[model samples]
Target chain A: MNKQKPSQILKTTFFSFLLIALTSCTKKSDKEVSLGALIAMTGPIESMAPPILDSVRLAEKEVNDNGGILGGRKLKVTVGDSKCSAEGGADAAKKLVNINKVSGIVGALCSGASTAASSGVAIPAGVTMISPASTAPTFTTLKDNDLFYRVIPSDAYQGVYLGKLVIKQGITKVALTYVNNDYGVGLANSFKASFEKEGGKVVTESKHEDKKASYRSELATLAQGGAEALVVIAYSDSSGQTIVRQALETKRFERFIGTDGMASEKLIKRIGIQGLKKSFFSRPVATKTSFSDAFDKNYGAFSKHKRKSIFIKEAYDAAMILALAIQKGGSDDRASVKANIRKVANAPGVEVGPGDWAKAVKLIAEGKEINYQGAAGANEFDKNGDVAGVFGHFVVQMGDSFKQIK
Target chain B: MDTLYGWMMYILSLLTVGGIYAIMGLGLNLQWGITGLFNIGVAGFFAVGGYASAIVTTKFSPNHLGGFDLPFIVGILFSMIFSGLMAAIIGKICLRLRGDYLAIATIGLAEILRLILKNEVWLTNGPRGIPGIPRPFEDLAQPWSEICYLLIILLILAIIFYGFEKAINSPWGRIMKAIRENEEAAASTGKNVENLRLETFVIGSIFMGLGGALLTHSMKYIGPTASDPLVTTFLLWVMLIVGGSGNNKGAIIGAFIIWTVWSASELLSGILSYEWINRLSYLRVFIIGFILQVILQNRPQGIIPEKN
Candidate 1:
């Protein structure tokens, strides 16, 4: 065994290399139009990736089920794991663009990955990229050459919408806390600007980082200022849950408010509905027809966390919309996909809802316009390729669930 | 033809990232192989370099942020300087200790540095990070800009490798080897062993920072995730050891080999559909660990041993 050590190691290396070579020889056929999905398969928010990819695949299945895309060509989706970082994004985008040679991409959920992949790889390669959940306002001004777009509303839009809803509830004074990152800061800044303009008082504000053992110090600051309620703009599963539990235990404030980040059933289950009876949350309003019956049924065959999985709706929409663009443009060309994203997702067109692929394709075939009011909502692309979204008010119901107010 | 162009760009990127890792591997080789210092804070120095360059490229004050159009070299120089300064401080405190104690001290300190980079949003932009860093020759047309960037990286790597080789043959290089072999014996000869060790460590750390800055420039973005210890610090150590400690060429070869496998294994695994989703992504990490184990088991002295 000792004498054979070096050769054995070499053999192992050779074997693995051979495996890689054999696995990588998958050839794309001419009858298929490939789109890439750049999701974080490994990293901090890794648990969410597999499910979200399934939702995007669900869109692919939806397209292929109803005849196909681009004059009977099958829609093929190649997956690239962005790993939730800039380097990961650039690396994955390079492979997806070069090796896979996809015309479009969808669902790089992390903002950092989306920006880097867009600017570094996708934009330079002239590939159209649609992020399912990147909400940075910076993208609005990115020199993307109109090749980048997102299904999610900009943080700027959701925050401003939430501010109007807060004032409608007649809460004039409140304490505010948010996780100090791009998502939190963007939403908080927009919310503050809109709330202050609507004649409300943000008596105190504190920004805290995520995954801390305790947020008592920040909570203490928020507890002061004699505010009527405390606002939390953070993910419910982590820091948001900790802050809410600590706040109630300390009896600092009776009323609580949360933004899109806090709109989760986990909070209601973890903290109990009794303690959060007066608490309210805001999320980007999904239309009733959004996540339609067919979508729910199709997605049910995969993960049970349909409502709980973050960005599943947006991921589905992003894939479907990109498919629609390819179909409407009548080609698998990257430039045409970019050129027709707006044409397929905006008003003054034949209305298409989720799972209405057949209807949309028929309209496209007839040389009529098509509009994809998707699983998220009506995705009307603006000059900067951003879609405006409305915020929905939600409250904890008796069954440990969130009931959205229309 | 477009597909062909895309494949070419992909290969260029693999080389680009591999070159960046080779630079960092050289840094680690100097620290561990030349001077016998267990510097475990590679990621800390990396973050310092990346954030330093990012801040230099643009104004990110609380009041206003501006367009980033500064000379890329200025940011790179700043990264190396800041990293060197940080290394100087860390070396002063930890070099007094020996072996594993020094490793523990450096690791703890680096964690503190990581937290500072993460929490201090004004400088590093926290987790959201800074993007749109203009790279040298990025404005040039496709493939050429990429080609130019890769050339600069390889050119830098060659210069550093040549410098290291010359240093190894010089009196300083011989002294470093002496200190590594028998520290007490070298000190008895009044060689100022402490100062020499500190210098080796600081120089090695400077290279780590340089590598980080180049990476940020290549990606045109940086975030807290860029400095993740698993990806940066631990990965560099693997490259150094598997390549061959105390061998400059070994380090370069090691970096290219390891990083190519790391990135390309992902590409290879990308062939697998989501039907095997759970196994696909982790397969890259698994392959890397397997390679490291095989290399360490077969050649503990590395692919290129320190030649007498």
Candidate 2:
């Protein structure tokens, strides 16, 4: 090997990498206050990222158009793909916190990603992170040191709610199956505990892997349990779809119960209304608020898929609340944003909603308080930064829709 | 902090994670490069290490098994021990199968490990995972805490690197190299080839476990998805192969360089248009593959080829 060749190659590669690093270190304009969005752009939730990003962009646009943030400085959002895993989340969040120096973060959507980012990066780095889609029960008890918050409720609460709903419907014995993941496990375990406590019986339980060719053997065992219905705690596009179709064809359990993941139009299209006539699904209901009219009227202009996805409203709420917190705190400091999140989200303030950022800013300037009522609901965050969820019970209608029964 | 300091902090993260991967690269180098043991089941040992470390060190929680709340060194040892035990069992059964067949068995081991971690709710907390694994020096201030953690990782890497170097130069190293080149001839010389192969397998796996434990502590959380084969298994192979597998320094250098590329490519969006930032961000994975292909074409034996 030539002596100069190795050094030449090394120098060339080293300078190029230095160039990339230097380019990324370009400073943010002082006129802008930046935030980070940790969406799952490449992992399991890739399908859900587009609209969620749109919602975040909507919040940014709405805030800028109204009054901007902090006496008319632009509110900029930097995007980081969490990739729906711990490593991805930690890496993205580290870049956001250290390199971009974002005052607050609004994502890392998957629960596992969120947990790692919050505990490992954001909390330690003193940057506040708010997740709109992560619903693992772990965050409720995680020692986040007051730096982590989520607009959505944990799956543990929803599981208990489903448990009570099932008993109220007079269904005693049911065979349960959940796709094995954080969401499925959290919801299923909590539901089982609550159901058993409320004098109901889960005759058999099975946890199956998602995206499988068939769950025939698992279904065979579940079918033998002699149950009133089959509770499928999985997404409609994955294992839930297969289980439902197989159960229908085999004449297993006639009645069925599903969670928000199963409450979709695609289910009716494939299974038809007849097969799902005895089936009902549960989903978190968007509350009727004064802001609802504004969101319904204007959100269509901003987003193509207005109601096509879950957590769009919550996503909007998370970003908007961050902006409001920045305005209320009147500083670009990380600690300021963390201290102000609950102040702007909680009660006893002049109510503000989406597209009303100007009024909210004016209120903050006046040394008055304002509570942000967002597109989703009045997200009153508890001590753990979790909101109490309100779920709706729905049954399949004759056409391609679901009717809220209660 | 200022932008330059921010950049430095990000570099520390790069090295922290990079050092961990270097540990894994060393293990892969020992097994495949030194002993020619085709053990592709690094992900299984990795998960075992992560879960064991997490279970051993975490505070009392109803989730998963352990509430012992042991210290950091204990967590690391447990992770290595558990992974070593798994390697011993699997090596006893499948180490006899050479080359590609061993690859298939290791793949099965990875899948089985992932399934167990996902399904065994009472033990491993199922897929919800055990959160809040302790990080040493986390109680200190920002840059210092991060500095200390990175130092600890580098120190571990140094010890492992030193140990491997000593081992690679010893007479035992010559015998292992002999076995790698001509296994039948080495066995004919009565070097106890099977035991040496098993020893190499178990020792390499012990380092992989250490890598996994370090990752868990740094990330402060672990789940089944975090141990995805794409990152854990395939990436280790690329690192060792690109670094020139025969030498320990190549393994270390390859890990740092590859990880730097893997991580810094995500920041390319800083120069792109706002509309293209999110859309073009995925080109990172493509960029890594492109670089790997370019390097393979230029230098098949890697950047620092084994010096005979």
Candidate 3:
């Protein structure tokens, strides 16, 4: 019995050591240049993520097709759904950085999700992040900073532009109705500040919680307030659509203005042509642009319907910029790649896009200067890592079409 | 100095969380410890309180509900009352079941409540949630006064604790204990066990509701995601168990200790640079589990075992 016990103990010890060695070996061999993409694939903000993910995939396919980055090392983009919540985003970020050992991350479509993931997982892991859509100003001023970058300008810039647009529309008194979220509040406050500064009067400012049915009374109140224009700042979800529909039904205001969150093809689809007409929304214009044609062609091939929203173009540009930066760095080293992102994205000279990246990459490799003007516009990352893009006011015309007011 | 201040702030934050959890734990203790009624749906009641108070206070428009912007005290009071009322209704239906069946029913109800919050965009703002809720002391001359906020919450907790203590000491508490020890024996002694259990369940739910309201105000943001089962439900259970189940002081102490550990672990993880430690985020959960196991082994009754 004693001899049998000794033999069993020895066998157990051998297996334990063998298991540890196997695990270590697996860890060492698993460096396939993993890059994490955290997007809201579910939850309230989920509608915004699918297009972003598609854009990331398109970029990945293009990179891999052209012999990949870092001396033929194929780039793998692992997408994680943040669910647009703090805890969920943090969990997704952790899994991406820890389990996948991803050197770089792109995503967190929602602002709150970005904040949660950035603070908890990405920054701590020293993984560089470039969000395509998150526009909260607070992210640029994080206390425990990391190599954070974004292709979209802050709501600060958008708010000013929106305010200017409102003033230019010859509307003096405006009624502001916003969803009670950070995204809405921040943009609304900024617009209010700049609008008031620009000599525009906001008659009645009210906040509505998102996703409630029947906004007829609120719309009526805004109408009753005798405001010429109503500014709706909210997500491009059902709630925002409901608000717009209710406003249209009431026929209260002369004009309706919406922010970027309301600048979506889904919004048009939800509200139909009749609801969308006479409504002017501020969005990053994609027409008469270099990459717009290419995006239209590529997205036309990929999607049954031609992609015509500003978000799709911005998301595509964000992915393209990240890929270009990786190509410029000549290595998958996260820190160096992160540092070089701003350089490649906001490079000097002619603007570039996914189609132009090959030539740009070759020139960059040969120590020549290049500028990447994306489909959305110039990918210029400002001092705070925000892009400076033109925010144009577009009036929805006939079915699925909008005319930008120059 | 900054580090110390941060730690102080963390402790203060934990105290606030602990106070809320303690109140929640007391409710559980009243049900499980006193009346032998098991309710795993504390989160549901808590969420109801938050949503109810939020909708009531905020104004309602044709498109969305607006907050009434009432005083925080009024909101808190309304939350408690509504939660208690909800508990009475739920208890009337499910409290008749004993043991695991009752637990399952409550848990299912909690899940249903969460789904309602998530899907009913018209009511709870769906998944996007409500933000920019008015802070209690925003109108104060010095607004960012954590001390004032802490003291106010602490005072509220004290009153609740005192009230609970007084109630538990009275004849009502004895009957509750009697029901807990042996329902049949209590019935034989001419006690209405069902009514006592229902009352205990309702009262406990009220505390949970109030705690939820207080918590929402502290964050100044309320979302369906925040009141999730994993975040609110699991944590409450951890707090109650770590504290002695039947003891209010133990509940408070457990909440404080566990929250401190959780916060400290997070801070440690944040500051550490090692790849292994940085990567091993789940290590914290494992450590918590291990510590809990050790505690259970060494002191099965908990940090402060309830005294009969």
Candidate 4:
């Protein structure tokens, strides 16, 4: 036994120590309330992540500036990348809940990430997660035990609204192409059900996986359905640009409708302003309130990345709600934060809008209830932690800008 | 105290996932390393195994079919059988192709399988995927359940490693290697190269299936994303190649090292500030590729060279 090489033993020991050092680095500050921001910092929806993450940091700074939560215990945010997939979401949630010891998580922008993280890690670990952008109705069925919440309305609402709007705009026939994931399938099914119910015919619906070299064949198949318009539900950074560009080049279907995922200036830049002139899309409205204004002003300071402002409002709102809940819950305990999240966001209290956290903290100290009306919309969560918000109708005008259409 | 536990649990999850991939790496080693068959559709057989188990075990739902509510062991057994059957079918036609052509065909098969999983809404439930998969011993409290599952993975990996080591050292394995070196020479020497290749392919795919089945159970979900060619197929190749092509122990070590690098990079991204993560969002990917390049350059025969 003693004949074994000492160098091999030394090498093995060194590697073991290195592994331990690499894995054991979580240290929670006693004077801080840590919140996790699990977002799509990479993967297919990478383009949309920066502004939303920036908004979260802005809200974090605002919370700390306003005397922090629970009498100067500063609110610190730890960001985790969801990568917009179930596995990515679950891994991120595990790190956030277990390693970071965050009282609450403020994202998971994609639906697949939201539900997966909840079932896989967050709910089991008793960590509260408030999604700012995940809108799939599938989340409504999660046996989350009251640990899951979201700032956006479900796709059910958006589908119904858009379906009605498509018909009202005199589009009688439409073909649909959606990304073949939870987000796409859920929204597509909802829209199909609503569109058919509204006496409109969906000529054909196709699902596309992301990162395909060309969607020309899918576009051709969609065009063959003799539809007057196409409804594309996909992220701008993925197959959305290619689908739009190919559809335009082939003159397959000039008239198009899109959802929030495609509501971006990048879409216009890719397809050109003239290419998308006949296109209209629906997305959650960014309210012109004090909260949004403050967010727009402060976002640049935190991040130099160009702001798309798509889900930035919701991100800010989610961060604010988590922080306020931490303050009202009176401790950094996750259970306490989860229990009191609704207390700070519902009605029958003094109204607190964006930038009013200092006042809201004062009101909470004075034994007064407060309702936080977020920059995105009314901050109310139903039994399922779902919100109801208005979807804005917009058209791409000249100069690659979105013009709100009444 | 909880932080320490959290870190431990996080490491356990990484090891568990790494263990599953180790099984896959072993299977690929049997095909590409031992038998000289480039079965690049590692994820295809994996998905087949995952769906086979998921269909039988999951409860009856309107979304998909065959919710037989079978026991967990039945699911695992069926997953292996199903994947083996698929490998047999694919190998029957594709084993005729050699080298690069086999690689191309297997990669295409993987894409075709992913498409089928996506479009066959009635069968695989399409992109929404099969969630709510019941993990064995899920009734146990969390971190404990997770730890138990990790043990299960480790047990499976150890069994596979032992079995694979024995198989590759057997007379049958020597014939496969002879065929891999020179098929014409092996055929002339009275070995049925075609049949041996097919048998090896099927056997290798069965191991991949078991790995996939275990992963699906642990994750409690299976989707198209889970079977991404880049993650499952390419990464397994990197694992086997980087660890050592023909050595079973090397394959396991490779899986652990590569998966640790993959996950650890993501963890680093999380630790870095948003400005750094945003400006260099692909830094994780860059680091992985750079490490692989360095390994490939420094050890062309792999960290553990294939034993003669």
Which has the higher DockQ value, candidate number 2 or candidate number 4? 2
Instruction: Please provide, for model 3 over A335-374, each residue's C-alpha lDDT reduced to its tens digit, 9 standing for 90 to 100.
Output: 7777777777765754666566567767777886667777
Q: Score the docking of each candidate (DockQ).
A: 0.54, 0.57, 0.07, 0.45
Q: Over the full model, what C-alpha lDDT does candidate 1 score relative to the true structure?
A: 0.84
Query: Which should have the higher DockQ, number 1 or number 2?
Result: 2
lDDT of 2: 0.88
Between the candidate structures 3 and 4, which one is better when assessed by TM-score? 4
Weakest 10 consecutive residues of candidate 3 chain B by summed lDDT:
B269-278
- In candidate 4, stretches whose alpha carbon ends up further than 4 angstroms from where it belongs are A1-28, A162-184, A192-285, A300-302, A305-308, A392-406, B279-281, B293-308
Between prediction 2 and prediction 4, which has the larger TM-score? Answer: 2
Residue-wise C-alpha lDDT for candidate 2, range B55-121, written one tens digit per residue? 9999977878975799999999999999999999989888888899988988898688878887898
lDDT of 4 at A240: 85
The alpha-carbon root-mean-square deviation between model 3 and the true structure, to one decimal in Å, is 10.5
**10 residues in a row with least lDDT, candidate 2 chain A:** A21-30
- Per-residue C-alpha lDDT of model 3 across residues B72-113, encoded as one tens digit per residue: 788888899989988888899999899999999999987788
Clashing pairs in 4: none
The C-alpha lDDT values of all candidates are 0.84, 0.88, 0.71, 0.84
Model 1 regions more than 4 Å off: A1-29, A209-220, A223-226, A235-252, A263-280, A301-308, A394-406, B1-3, B59-69
- Candidate 4 on B1-308: residue-level lDDT in tens? 56667778889888988999999898999998899998899989989988888888988877787778899899989999999998999999899999999999998987797788877988987867777777887778977888888888898888888888888899998998998899999999887889999999999999898888888887677767667676788788888888989888889899999988877666665578767876444776676678779888999778888899
Q: Write the per-residue lDDT of candidate 1 for residues A284-371, one digit (tens) a residue.
A: 7656674455667678875666555778878898898889888888887888998899989998887888779988889888999888
From the highest lDDT down, the ranking of the candidates is 2, 1, 4, 3
Q: Give lDDT tens digits, candidate 1, residues B1-308.
A: 45556667878888898899999988888899898999898989999998888778854444123324468888889889999999999999999999999999999998899889877766676766777777889888887999999999999999999999999889999999999999999999899998999999999999999999999888788777778787798788888888898999889888888888887877754567666655666777787788889988999888988788
